[model samples]
Target chain A: MPPVLQIIDLKDSQATRSYLTKQTLRSWLLTTDHKRVGLLYLYTIIVFFAVAASAAAVMRLNLLTPRGDLVQAETYNKLFTMHGVLMVWFFLIPSIPSVLGNFLLPLMLGARDLAFPKLNLLSWYIFVFGGGIALYALLIGGVDTGWTFYTPYSSTYSNSHVALMAAGVFVAGFSSILTGLNFIVTTHKLRAPGLTWFRLRLFVWSLYATSVILVLATPVLAMTLTLMALERIWKVGVFDPALGGDPLLFQHLFWFYSHPAVYIMILPGMGVVSELIAAFSRKRVFGYTFVAFSSLAIALLGFLVWGHHMFVSSQSVFAGVIFSFLSFLVAIPSAIKVFNWTATLYRGSISLDTPMLYAIGFIGLFTIGGMTGLFLATLAVDVHVHDTYFVIAHFHYIMVGGMVMAFMGGLHFWWPKISGRMYPELLGKMTAIVTFLGFNLTFFPQFILGYLGMPRRYHAYPEQFQVYNVLSTAGASILGLGYVLPLCYLIWSCCYGKPAGNNPWGAKGFEWETTSPPPSENFEKPPVQTEEAYAYPVPSSEPITE
Target chain B: MNARAILYEQFSDLEQQRESSLAGIWAFIASEIMFFGGLFLAFTVYRLNYTQAFNEASQHLNLVLATLNTAVLLTSALTMALAAASNKMGWKYSTLLLLMVTTLLGALFLAIKGIEYIEDWHKGLFPGSAFAWTGSDPGHVQLFFVLYFLMTGFHALHLMIGMGLILVMLLLTWKGWINSRHFMPLDVTSIYWHFVDLVWIFLFPLLYLLGAKI
Candidate 1:
């Protein structure tokens, strides 16, 4: 046999003693293991992603013609509401953090498990219970309040399952809180002996930033949802303008949690892209401290810019300008990240691996997303595009194009470690390309249509806009294909793919020090980090700017 | 040696375990602050908009009972602090006694709050359709009452959770699961108890005292 197959056989023999060795269902369901919890989250979120994507498919089909003949207008409202709610709370928000963060944090720290392993298990249970409640609301006539659940309509007017959906989201917010709390405590307390602050991976830093937002911001959302639900039930509660309460107060409170929520969704993806870029390029990340601090900057600055979303809601012009300016400030840290990633790739032994494809795609797409965000942040421009598809396209570029691409990249990058198997690389690269092409084809034209006076959430449009609608729906089909291909191949790889030895990609993180599908205890003995992160052996002329 | 038995498997030593638990609870409390902070913010906005009506509604609250309840909560905090201190000093029976006193004080505060709710109901101060307020601005007064009930009700909910946790600590102490050497549970619980008390400290002034200056 060749040397590679011999090594594969050696690694394959160890799989019997790994975390996957347990075949009993009870072990998985009641596991306090962070890796198992992460896998549980991975399975749960994938199901939610499929459900939300199906909702998007129906909506896209409905929008294929100038006149929406596929679903009724009310159904379309419900469709988008379900899509937005699931995609935001169920899928995107928890995608990277709960799954990858839960799996990797302990491994990277070389700890036995998360600080509170039982709490980690509880977070997953809360997530699933909350997901069940949200689905139940959908079954009993879905809510149409948009995921925003903007007031007056959600509180008084809309006659759908508003309170039930709010309750679902309210319960789910605790999961995010617990996960954030667990991560913060673990990062503070559980690092291996020599793993000081700067020596940690950028992913850990970004997650720490993300957790700070998650811990502080999610509770406000929980309370806001509770108040909204109470208002819907009481009819005389807060946010009812007729009752001398202000609807704008609801908007302020909701966005206070939500704008930070956007960071929660994408920051982990940025962390993931950071790791992928460094690992695949085989170089130290350029300006490590700057990149680490930029994550913190984005989290801190994310809070002050919530009011930008309120600029057109009769908010004071002075406040709008401040919010608009603060909104512009967020782009600086984001640009720092993009520039540093690009700089890391320069003069490095760059490999066009599957993960690198997604990372590069993220840099290009996130730049587009970040730049368009400034247009919306401008006070004068927002007046025209507020609540339009321009707003829709901008966020999708961030959430879908940016976050989702980074998620796929991280998943592929970490797949061998996660599943102890290698997915077919050609198919992985093809999915990345198709997803990038499909995402832009779907959303890019919507920006044009929005600028040309097409509003969002409308089932029917003017005949002049039908061509773009057609193009978007076509892109939706391709995007759906991109998502489905991974589900099939990744699952197939789990059972049939060739056994991948430890450190298949020659990655340098502490996680790569252990076996793929690491033992239930994570490491046989605790690891002490000695080298700085992404310290590629090839000497770079770049000075280590601490 | 007994404390060693209580250490979780994930931590390297007892000190790291205690440190993590403290950090974890503090993080939890920070989130709780934002939770209550949202309601406080809404109250601030509406109070500014309808100052007179909110003041009028605030005046109707039974200040005497609420003041009494405030004293009850403060005493509970003192006892809670003593309990934590006693646990650290390894005085098993005294710690249990102080914990019981703290839990009772919490119950007394809740009972007084229940009486105040009944009094408010008799005065038709509730926010629903039956709210019998003919004040300067009935709508705004109703809004004021809506916020008052929500804030105080949520605060009461948190106190109940704290009380339940205290009961668990009491049992653990009785079972000798929490001793001086392994007092992190009691320590963490006291922090939570004090946080609840502090929230009430803010609420008493915001809801009950805002109208006192007038």
Candidate 2:
């Protein structure tokens, strides 16, 4: 046998004694083990993703015709609301952080587990409980207040399950806060010996930045939702303009958290892409400090740009100009990340693996999403496309295109380590191609629709926009297929795929130092980091062998 | 080996574990500050926008009861601190006693707060459309009462959670699970208790004292 297969067999035997194979279902449920908790988050988030994607499917089908044909106008409203709520809170926000972050942080940092392991378990329970309540609300008659829950309609007019949904979100916000707190403390206090701040991987840096946003911004969301719930339940005028409450006050409080929330969704993806770029390109990341600091810069600058979302909400032009300027400034850090990743790949031994494909896709799509954002930030352009499909297209590009692509890339890249098996490479690459193509086909036309003066959130539309709607629907089906492929193949790989030894991709990180599906305590002993992260070889066609 | 020396299989030593636990609590407190910070920001904006109405509405609060509740919470913080200090000193009996005192004081604050809520309800200070505030700008005044009830209600919920945590600590102390070196549960709980107290300190001044001189 070859040396790699010999190593694979040796590690495979050890992996059978992993946290997963040794535990019963009851033990798994009650586990304080970070790996088990990470799996728990993974399974739960997939369920939420299915629900949200189904909602998206229905919305796409409904939009297929110029006249609304599939669902009633009210049902369509609830459909989009459910899609927004489930996707934003249940899926995207926690996607990489809870699942990959929980699993990898300790492994990457060489810690045994997170700082507060029990708190880690509790955060999962809190998330499930909150998601349960929200799901229950959806079953009982859904909330139609658009996930934004903008005032007067949410507080006074709408007679749906606004309070229940808000309560669910309010409770879920705590889960985010606790998770953030755990990550922050672990990153600060639990690094292995000799693992100084600058020696950390960029993924760890991005997790740290994401955690800062999670810790600080999520609480504001909790408070804002609490007030919204109170207003809905008590018939108070906190947001009702007719009752002398300022509607703008609600907008200010909501966006203050929501804008930072976009970063909470994408920062982890950026971190994942950094890992993918370094490993596949077989080079140390170019301008490591710039990329690391850009994560922090994004987190800090994210807070100031919330005003950009409120540009047309009766906000002063002066405030709009300031917000527009800050919004443009926030894009610089994101641009820095894109540039750094490209520079890292320049003339390097680049491998077009599945994960690298996704990373490259993320760069292109995020650039487009981010640049269109500048258009929205421009005072006059925003006035034109304020509530149009352009806004819808812009966010989907960032969220679905940028973040989701990176999420898939990270998941595929880390799957061997996570599940102790190598997924089929050809299948993985095919799915990546399908996802990118389908995602673009689905959203790219919305830009044209918006530019042609088609507004969003309407159940019915004029006949002129039918071609774009049809194309978007067609793309949705393909995207849906693309997403389903991984769900099926990944599960199959988990059970039957070839065993993946440690460091299948020959990544130069501490996490790759351990066996695939590392034991419950992670490393057999504490690992002391002695080298800079991503210390890949210069122009090596093959990964270095021990 | 001592039962408490399990070290949780994660940390290298007891000291590292204890420090990590303390850091976790402090990080949680930092999040709590932002949680309450949002409400405070809203209050500041509304207060500036509707100064006279807020002050006039604030005057309707039962000052004596709120002030008494403030003292109760402050006393609870003291007892909580004493409990943690005693645990660190290996004084088991004194730790238990201080913990009980802290829990009782927290409960006392809640009791007073409940009475004040009932009084406000009777005085028609609720924020419904038919609220009976016969003052200038009833709408903005209603806004004040809305904020008052919301902030205080959330604070009470937090106190209840704190009380529950104290009860857990009490049980653990009685069972001998927590002692001098194993006092992390109590220590972290005390940090949380003090956070509850700190939130009240701000709420007292913002909600009760804003209208005093006006």
Give me the displacement of residue B6 in model 1, in angstroms. 1.6
Would candidate 1 be rated incorrect, acceptable, medium or high by CAPRI criteria?
high
lDDT tens digits, residue span A1-546, model 2? 235645455655664667777757889888988888999999999999999999999999999998889999999999999999999999999999999999999888999899889989999999999999999999999999899999888988897999899988888888899899899988988899999999899999999999999998999988888787777777777777887778898898999999999999999999999999999988889999999999999999998988888878999999999999999998889989999999999868888999999999999999999999999999999999999999999999999998899999999999998888899899999999999999999999999999999998888899999999999999999999889999999999988888888789988988888778787778867889888988776774566679
DockQ, prediction 1: 0.90
lDDT of 2 at A150: 92
Total backbone collisions for each predicted model: 0, 0
Instruction: Give the TM-score (vs. native) of candidate 1.
Output: 0.98
Top candidate (lDDT): 1
Checking candidate 2 for backbone clashes, the offending pairs are none
lDDT of 2 by residue, B104-179 (tens): 9988888898899888888998778547977689889988988888889889999999999999998888777898
Worst 10 residues of 1 chain A by lDDT: A1-10
- Candidate 2, residue A155: lDDT: 83
The reply for model 1, stretches above 4 Å from the true place, is: A1-8, A540-546, B1-5
Looking at model 2, residue A95 earns an lDDT score of 94
| DockQ of all models, two decimals each | 0.90, 0.78
